[model samples]
Target: MDLTIHQNCPSCGAPIELHEADRLIRCPYCEVKNFMVSRGVLRFVLPDRAPENIERSEMFYAPYLRFKGNIYYCKGKHQKYKVVDTTQQGMNARALPPSLGLRPQAMPVSLVTEEIQGTFLRQTVKAKTLLERAALLTVIDSEKIKAPFYHRAYIGESLSCIYLPLYIKDEILYDAVTNKPLASGGSAENMRKSGSGYHPTWTPHFLATLCPQCGDALTGEHDSLILSCHNCHSSWAEQQGKFHSIDWSCVVSAETSMYYLPFWKIRVRSTAFGLETFADFLRITNQPLVIQEKHTEMDLVFWVPSFKLRPSTFLRMGKNITLRQAKIPDGEPKMVQRMHPVTLQRKEAIQSLKSILAGAALNKKKLLPLLPDLSFQPMSTELIYLPFSDKGHDFVQEQTGISLAKSVLHFGRKL
Candidate 1:
């Protein structure tokens, strides 16, 4: 019996057939890509769209809404009410080091701010700031520039930073909102104790750190405390009775921005060759075995930036269009020549990408050959923030609005 499964491109709606050794597959339709699976209890499917909101242009440039550390006034462009920045070249190509004479790069500073306030361990933590993303290399040939040593001047190719916004929801599990953790699980006498601090669990919109020892997942329990491991046997608390390595969460500061980071998916084909020969004195036996190795040319797809062509902050329509269709004004091209786009939730997309990198490291394989091993295909999607303001906006409500708008507008566009 022959087993043939019909598959369609998630982005452009192209018809495709499943192939046995074809781990990485691209759609002929819209260039939306996907991964292949041969067996096992496969879990997790990549989303077709980003789950967060684009702010629908409601978040205007308001001095009253700005925080002290915002990079907006000095760094970004103000378009109407929204703060805007556009990329003229492909981020992938810009990743190349200018010092190496690979490509030209631009490094921009950040501007935006928000106030963060919350209680962790009965103590109040208050601060005002914006979020920023690390400066990264944007290369034209993502496949060629795998190592940093190849780049010339690192400064030019790297991006400055983006200050994005996030929402945080918290829950208190203690016996009383005013009582300390000792009071919740302690004797009645503990309730009368003085100078006791309340214990609360904090859940942030995005995750930034992980436990190094067991690779167990972690979450911020409070402004100062972190719930490191979900496994009970795991050691989360240090000698100081606090989670270790949690200070790393500071990486996602208010200066963080949504960027058009570039990446390359590579494909390599190889064959085996030659044979081992042995010489013996008695009863010489002859063996016939020849090894052959064939290396196939690498195929690549550069991950590029995706923006709605409409004036609206959200994507309104299109089932099919050319490569020039879904882009922001004066947008840049991806560094890599060929690429497959996949639409995935922000969280899942990052996770899947990380998994590919990690798996490649452990398996001693290059990413180019591991393209087919990826769980989801690539898509042009935005990495955006829910944007929170202690003064006016509720992140929850904003996220809900964004989700509703995306579902309605995703499939309604023209190519």
Candidate 2:
């Protein structure tokens, strides 16, 4: 599929085309880089192939919501999940196709700009409705209605509004791009009367990448959610289109290293569960290790990777790191290079809170009932980089015994 999106460089006003996954825009003409920020879900449109006679302003289009994410659901005594990637119509228009099918993967798409004016179909369908439907569409079994599914969460979610080209000719609805007859309305005239036109009000917004504390240029990969400044040794994350400094530290050693992987260190407060201290965790999860007096003073922190990976690997890494969190010491305020991009955000990492808790539990019978009442509210969050010793096949963090396959690192980048 053509996922190339075009945007004008803020420095030189030169048109630059980028992949859909790219957030950092680089302008070749001006040799400047800026980060793109969006307050809501990103938007895109399919390439139009209509005849030249059609007026661009008067044309009609259909809206589809595209969802690509990892799904986690807690049902009965067990937790289940799947990696889902699908799309559905964004409105209740019966005249158009219910789903976008494989069209987005088959062809190219562009960012919907103010330059294109058309009767963009109104998105009356709620995104929550589609999110529920996507899970059922890709199920392990034709799951029967067993009710009372206590928890459901989506992580690493990539939501976008995709517009399909459409038009009316001779009182009949037709796909403007493929010229195939569509199922929308009995006739073209009926669709125009029934369908409400949507006015384009939002455009993609970009921000200059500069350190808030120091007058230094921020550096990060194309899809990085966290950008850092080497001069000031500061890290930044975006919240509602604004960049904010993050509480970050690095476990630096005197020896040379290859790369540092970022992780989210989260401390959660629960009114129903006693999860504040390491002693509480030992009792809750029923660990074999003896709980010492020091364990009560040590606060428990959930360590989640700040990058995407396969579901199994993601869960394993999170569970293992969290279990040995006490082994990690207070880090130094130092700058580091050769780091993996933070593809996953703090919001997405929090979705795995329950899943990681469930995974860490030794006795499900005791923990299952508590899962319904347990509410994990993040009291504090910090970004930390851990040094890993590179083996030929895997990278090992000797302090915590956290080992990640080199192959897994390469595979995660694609996700």
Candidate 3:
């Protein structure tokens, strides 16, 4: 059964819509608050367990000898299965206008055969590779993982989309001169009342009391969770949930904010060719294969795998620096090295390695047309307030987005 009630907030005596799971309610009218009952009496559905004795296999795509396109299939089920990348885009020459304040000149656009072909292969293989990778990583406690279909006869059945809650504390601004904090709070409220006694941090008035710059009160007519100091003109925002500060210091501000972020982890089986096709492909590609280098102790080679399941934008940049030290032959590092390392074998390695080399020369402005095919669903969100103060004059909000999503989108642009 479900329950609902209209109750007055104990702190502000304002009308509030109460639910079985609600522990506290805020009063917009009186700017007060109240406590709700039945916080522990909420109902919930159980999670499904992971499937047992699941069969896995190797997956791959082989380009045809002629113009017949390609072939896709899976290897036999085995205890171990690996992922490989085949996308490749190598560096090439391009015509550019004169530098050093010279006049612009018109020139014909030329296509680089090798770069284009490699980029095309990378785009084509990505969609299928991601699907295969997701299927392989799906091994988890079946009870917690979610699947669309469900039946008692099924060994593992779970909800497909689960809203996992989290806490995030983002600091917008830290005063350079004074040690005072001159920013708005970006934390959840529920977790704040978990304690008793007159806690100074729990109350908004305490943290928002003084301006970080001028050390003035932030009192205002706005009842919204976020407010700005009339003296500094800096504002902040927050939601009603649990939040905590991990570490507070002059360098960084850490706080906890509650939120629901989504993700899907799955496993799958795939196959690959048992033989090598070309050695040049191996040299330019980052695919996993054993290689012998002088003065090197290890004989084995491996690549890390990664996934951007949702829609995303990928931008590559390439730059040639004439180092003072002699350059090593055939030494091109994969861009995935910019992130945490994971297992990437066979085809996945080749593809990721190729993409990195292709865009190694991309500048901040010219992203070219290959910037699409890279996007993902939102993992988390937070409403943050940045602080700014001008000594004698008013301050203006920075030229970026006031929200996190927009800000990320802006910076995620080319380069």
Report every candidate's CA lDDT: 0.22, 0.79, 0.22
Model 1 Cα lDDT, one tens digit per residue, 1-415 = 1112344544464667542122234556654333332222111111111123423121111011111110111011111112222222111112111121111112111111121121111111111111122112223223343433211111101111111111111221121211222112222222123212221222111223345566655432121111333342222223222234311111111322311111222121212111111111000111122221311111112221122122222211111111111121222221221111222213322323322222212222332243333343343333221221122221111211221233222331211
TM-score of 2: 0.92
Q: Name the regions of candidate 1 deviating beyond 4 angstroms.
A: 1-350, 353-415
Tens-digit lDDT track for model 3 on 277-372? Answer: 222223333324454343123211211112121111221110111110012122111111011111111233233322332323123122212223
Error of 2 at 145 (Å): 11
Q: TM-score of predicted model 3? A: 0.18
Model 2 lDDT per residue over 154-203, tens place = 88878889988887666567788788877643555554555554444446
Worst 10 residues of 1 by lDDT: 61-70
Native RMSD of candidate 1 (Å): 28.5
The residue pairs in collision within model 2 are: 2-107, 2-108, 95-184, 95-185, 171-188
Output the better candidate (1/2) by lDDT. 2
* lDDT, candidate 1, at 164: 17
lDDT (Cα) of model 2: 0.79
